[model samples]
Target: MELLPFDEYVRSLDRKRMSAGVLFRDAEGRVLLVEPSYKAQWEIPGGSVDAGESPWAAASREVREELGIERVFTRLLVIDYVPDDGRMPEGIAFVFDGGLITNAEVAALELTDPEIVSAGLFFLDAVPSLKATLAARLAIALRAAQAGEPLLSENGTELT
Candidate 1:
């Protein structure tokens, strides 16, 4: 095979999109979910990972931007691979543990971002209302967090 130039070889590689999110929970076991102005469904605090940014950094930045709070996340809960479903390109999503937020902290949350309308705590049963893939990924993530382990998922299904 003919050798391709370095630039040509790099350009020939497929690029996959990535996103990162933070999972915050309350002492009562309710999870923090944010409602976005652009979407009807509620979501975790996170956004797309920009070019050249690490997933952990993206998660922290997204939390600060979306919730107007500075949070340090140290544990990864899940890495989910979302398959292309026509509307969106296939991408990888990283979910980090945001630890537990106290009731006072939850009450003090103020969303200043135009993208996010509101943020609130909800029980796990409410998770089913989320998008199918997200629901699946979150289920596994929660389990992993409770078990003090990280998990891998594909389209929301846990891989053995």
Candidate 2:
């Protein structure tokens, strides 16, 4: 048997894409969702984790980059494993607790040009009407938020 260098061995494995998003709420408990110019469906404030970036950091970075607001992630909400759907590779999606933003904070949110079209605060119950995959993830996130524990889900269904 032959062995390759540690770095070489690590590089030989298949890599999955990682994305992080933040779940924001208002005093009325409305979920904050953003409309991305690039996508047909609405999305939360987040993006793909860059190389060597932690998921938590990615969530914070995405919020700043996408919304032009600085938010500190309080805790992890949900971790979703999405299978490849013949278009993109398999991926792990993370939703972080964005904490409640005041009306002033919400008003101050600035959308990134050409990336974010607008932002809206919707009731948690309305999340299911969004994109299928996103709705699934947010459902898990809302549950995790209420329970104060992170959830493990596969495409939105909680894994026992």
Candidate 2 structure quality by residue, lDDT tens digits, 46-152 = 98999999999999888888888776785999999989989989999999998877767777877756788888888756753477778778878888988999999
The per-residue C-alpha lDDT of model 1 at residue 147 equals 94
On TM-score, the leading prediction is 1
**What's model 2's TM-score?**
0.87
Best by lDDT: 1
lDDT of 1: 0.88
Clashing pairs in 1: none
lDDT of 1 by residue, 1-160 (tens): 9999999999999899999999888777788888889988889999999999999999999999998878777799999999899999999999999988887887798878999887888886775357767777778888888999999999999998
lDDT of the structure predicted as candidate 2? 0.85
**TM-score per model over all chains:** 0.92, 0.87
